[model samples]
Target: MCIGIPGKIIALHPQQADCAWADVCGMRREVNIALIAEGDRQQLIGCWVLIHVGFALSKLDEQEAQETLAALHAMEEVEADVAMFLGAGEKR
Candidate 1:
């Protein structure tokens, strides 16, 4: 499934209106922030937000992001356990 996960905005390029840097988990990536309006833009930096199709869907708080990430991680762990239980090879 194609998903837009929550990421924290880490940097911004004022000279490049749409360009911004964000961290997905610990991986940093560049994304566009052009959709966000003038006054609201600054507030987005250092905050968690949802990104979809290279656009910012909505802003989220750190606590919310943490919870969501935790849930996703938990699900991944469960899936891994099930795969191991079924004797599924890494190549499978």
Candidate 2:
């Protein structure tokens, strides 16, 4: 399954504004915001976006982004538990 992470646009490219820097899960990375509307793009300096495969699929409200982040955190917790269990039990 393709996972899309919610992030906030922190910075934009000076020369080519197609791609901008986003703060995702506490980490900053370059993301493409070309898919969104030009009006929105023009004022996306502090907006949340659904980042998928290095591209910004769409813009999201702060509330929605927080909800998605909560879900993602829950899923991550489950994955970490599974990894720990697998590591504890060695394969033959």
| Candidate achieving the largest TM-score | 2
Question: Which regions of candidate 1 deviate over 4 angstroms?
Answer: 77-92
Per-residue alpha-carbon lDDT of model 2 for 6-79, expressed as tens digits? 88888887777699888876667778888873865658989999988789999899999999878877777668
Query: lDDT: which candidate is best?
Result: 2
* Candidate 2 global lDDT: 0.76
Computed on alpha carbons, the lDDT of every model, listed in order, comes to 0.66, 0.76
| Steric clash pairs (candidate 1) | none
TM-scores for all candidates: the values are 0.68, 0.79
Among all windows of 10 consecutive residues in model 1, the one with the lowest summed lDDT is 83-92
